[model samples]
Every structure is written in structure tokens, then in C-alpha cells.
Target: AVLTKGVTPINFKPEFADADAAEGEDTDPHAFQSVANAKIYVKNIADAFCTADAEGCDTYKANAAVYTEKLDALEGDVRTAIQSVPQEKRVVITSHDAFGYFEKAYGLTFLAPEGVSTESEPSAADVAKLVSQVKQDKAAAVFVENIVNARLIEQIASETGVKVGGTLYSDALSQPDGPASSYIDLMHNNIAQIKGAILGS
Candidate 1:
């Protein structure tokens, strides 16, 4: 693998590469900052390919432009969908913090028991704190990620008396036959699940 071979790891987007970045303060280095960063990441990859083959790079760039346009449209659609929901009603509960970037890019508030990874169990203290927060905030919904166990979220929902919302895609794409097979499908599915759960509850 290029990574194991010691190939330079470039930041897909600089904003997502810095450590000092904060949530609402500016773009966080570890999280997706905005939908526009999608274009920058694609363009950076295209530029990387050019280092080896200039001819192939041109084709990559052209294709990237087309895809970037599609991303633009997707961003607009997301904004429109989110605009329909009231601000205070945008709270959601999940088990991990992987959606920080999504919350930053979009306008939703995501509360989680674990930070960034699903490989470990969340501490009892963290779970207790989140449970308290959920009860106090009246979080609109609790959702399980495709890559995470549903037990934690289900527990939260039961304890808080909030319903379990639909599953969201994170960490990877869903199977082709599933609801979030493509990037666009993932975005649409997440927003729909969010809005449906919040509004319906």
C-alpha cells in the first residue's frame, strides 16, 4: 500500500488537517468543515495523480469538475432540506462522535457517548452524562450508525423516552442494495432520517 510504502500523506483539505480547529470557531482539522471541502479534496487527489502522470491528471481533473458540480447541487439540496426544520429541534443522539464534521457542515447538533471511533466501549460516566443531557435537552432523536451497535442508542432512547431514529451511514458506504450506497444517497438518507425523526417525534 502507498501508505505503508511511506508515500507522503497530504491533507485532503488543510482545514481538516490542523489540530487547533474548533467546532463553530472555524473548520476543524479532523472533521469535514463544509460541503465545499469536497471539491478541494477531489482536486487535491487529482493533483496528486498528476505528480506521476500528467496526461492522466488532465482526465482526472475534468472528471473531478463534473463531480464537484454534482456536490454543489447536493449541498444546495441539503441546505434546502435543513432549512425546513426549526433550529432548536435539530438535536440528535448517536453513540460515536464521527458525525462532528457533518454537524459542522450542516446545522444539526449531534450528542455522542464515544469520540470518533467505534472500536471501544464508552465509559459509564460518558453514558451517564449523555443520558442526563438528553433528558434535559429533550433531544429530538437517537440514531444508530451502520458501523455501530444499536444497543447503546436503543438504551439512550429508552432511558430518555425518545424514539430510536433511523440508522445513519458513517465510516463506509452501505451495500449497493441498501439505502446509502452512494455519497449522494448517504447525504439524503441522513437528512431524511434526521428530519423525519425530529419532526415526527
Candidate 2:
């Protein structure tokens, strides 16, 4: 009998979060996972720049517009890439709840052991619970995250028999030479890896 102690996190939510989820009680702070929200980040930054340096307002707006266009293209690309996988196979497993916004944006389902904040490690009970969920849901792939240790995910994958599809960039970007060096590249790499894993590529 596994002790469920230390299993339930403050940020834990039901696995099947609603489309407009108040998931994690509407407190998952990784809003940048969604490109649409990311555009808002750019706009806010541009607005701050314009306020700080009125003379550079035009330049700030122009730069924000350019980045926003790039984000638009990236959103479209993400949609197209994810379209290849059938909806039923869209379930994915990752290390934590960081991908909730991503799931909310891309029509994917993400299951994780930890909540949005990864300050603590998931216990054995959490892994066991997640393992059971993986089997029950027939989750397509499991991924390690760039910001957290992969040991927990590895244990979950081993027990559930789900392949460790690839590393997903969440909470941070990779080094300059890494595949996920930028926001656009990060989305592309994540979707490509997800698609490849689910489609058996």
C-alpha cells in the first residue's frame, strides 16, 4: 500500500481540466507557454518602453509588431504541426504542471506529478498515482523538462511503459546552440517531438 503522504500538492488539479480551465485554481503562472499570451507579454513590454522613453515609442512599437508577427506565424505553425496527431492520442505526460497553458492553447492534454511550482520533488505516491493515470489514460508520450530533474519522469515512464519522448522546454530556454534557443524554435521543437512520438516517427 503506497502512502499518499506528500502526494497532493497545493497546485494540484483534476487531470481533465476544462478548456477554459481555472486549473490549478486559475493560478498556473506559466502563461508564456501559449504564444497568444506571449504576444501580450511583448505588448506590455513595448508599452513600458514607450512610457519610459517617449522618444523611442515608435521604435518600441515597431519592434513589438515585428515580434508579434513572428509569434503569429509560430502559433499557426504549432497548430499545423499538432494536426498530424489524432485527438485521442494528444495526451502527453511531462514532469510538472507547467504545460497547462500549453494544453489550454493547443488542444493537448498534459498530465504531471508536480504542480506549477517545482520547488519540491514529487514523492513515491505521486509517481504511483501518475503511473496509474498513464496506464488508464493510455497517455502517448512522457517528456522530461528543461527546468527540472528527469528522475521522477523516468520512474513514471518505466512503470507505465511510456517512452520518454523527448525533453520539453518549460520555465526556461536552452543554451544558444540548443534546439530550443528561442520561443519559436522551442514551440517547434516541442511539437515536432510530440508529433514524432505519437505518430511513431
Candidate 3:
């Protein structure tokens, strides 16, 4: 409120069906997890810029077009990579519910103990429930995130008799020397880890 005291913030959060309820719907902010939604976000950004500065509209549109072309290619790559794995084997377990948008867009299932907010802690029952769900769902892989604690994911994997697959960059990119150093790399690295682990298992 303090930061936006004299300005209006444009919100581009994509709404999902089952995720809406009381408490004003626990929306997930990580919409960029999916390239499609990322394109929408880019469009929104471009539109906002054009509205705020008419002289820069053409530049913004041009830049957004160039970038979204790359995003389109990335989308194809993601689909082809994920499609190589069987539909039933596309389940993933992560530290939090950061991949809801990714799951919706990619036809994969992502289970997490904590909700959208990373600060929320799950109870013992919550962890137990997730462990059971992992076993029942035949989860393909359990992954640690660059932004969250890995102990919960490790425990879930251990209980389900699967190893922690790999590190996935969720809310942040990695260092320059790391695998997920950029948005495109982050998506590529995540899908590669998921596909390789699931197929190998």
C-alpha cells in the first residue's frame, strides 16, 4: 500500500477454477512457470507500457514480439520434451505449490505440502498425507527448489522410495555458473530433469 500510494498496479494473475474459494482465492503468483502465461504477461506489460507512454508503444510491441517468438519456440520445446514421457508418469513433487500454473499448462501434476505462500509450514499430518499421495499417485520425481528447504522433499522421496530427482529453480534463477541462470534455462533445466528422471525411473 505504501509503495503504490499514488499509482495503480496492473495485475495479470491468471485465474484457475478449482483454486478459487473463500479468502478471496489463493492465487499463485508464479504464472511465468508456463511459457503461454508468460506470453500473456509479456502482452500485459507491453499493453501497460503503451497505455502509459504512447510514444513508446511501437518499441514495446516490437520488443514483446521478438521475445514472444522465442517464448513460442520454448513452448514447443517444453511440449515435445514432456510428451516423450508417458502421461501417467508426469507427476512431480515440489517443495511448495509453485508449479500449479506449470501443471495446468503442461498436463502434469505437481503436489506440494505448503500452499502458495512459501512461509506457510505444513503440519505432520500434511507431510504424511503428501507422502501417501506420492505413493498412490506413482509420482515420477520429487524435486528440491532453489528457493525452498529441501528437507521436506527429501523426506517425501525417502518415504515414497524414490530419490530426490534434481534441483528446480522455482521463484528465482541461479547464479551465473549454475544450470538455471536464466528464465529459458530455468524452464529447460526443469523439464530435462523431470523427463530424464521420470523416464529413467
Error of 1 at 74 (Å): 0.9
Candidate-wise lDDT, in order: 0.68, 0.76, 0.74
TM-scores, in order shown?
0.73, 0.78, 0.75
lDDT of 2 by residue, 1-201 (tens): 222222222333454234216333555666777788888778888888888899999999999999999999999989998888898999887766677777878899887553332334667777777788888888988888776677777788899777787888876788999999988888888888888878878
Task: Judge candidate 3 against the unseen true structure and give its global Cα lDDT, from 0 to 1.
Answer: 0.74
Best lDDT among the predictions, by candidate number: 2
Ranking by TM-score: 2, 3, 1
Q: Model 2, 108: alpha-carbon shift in Å? A: 0.5
Q: Which candidate achieves the best TM-score against the true structure?
A: 2
Decide which is better by TM-score, 1 or 2.
2
Candidate 2 wrongly placed segments (more than 4 Å): 1-26, 114-130
> Model 3, range 143-200, lDDT digits (tens) per residue?
8887677777777777777657788777898899999998989999988888887887
Model 1 poorest 10 in a row by lDDT:
1-10
TM-score of 3: 0.75
Cα distance off (Å), candidate 2, residue 57: 1.1
Q: Listing every candidate in turn, what is its Cα RMSD in Å to the true structure after a full C-alpha superposition? A: 7.1, 9.2, 6.3
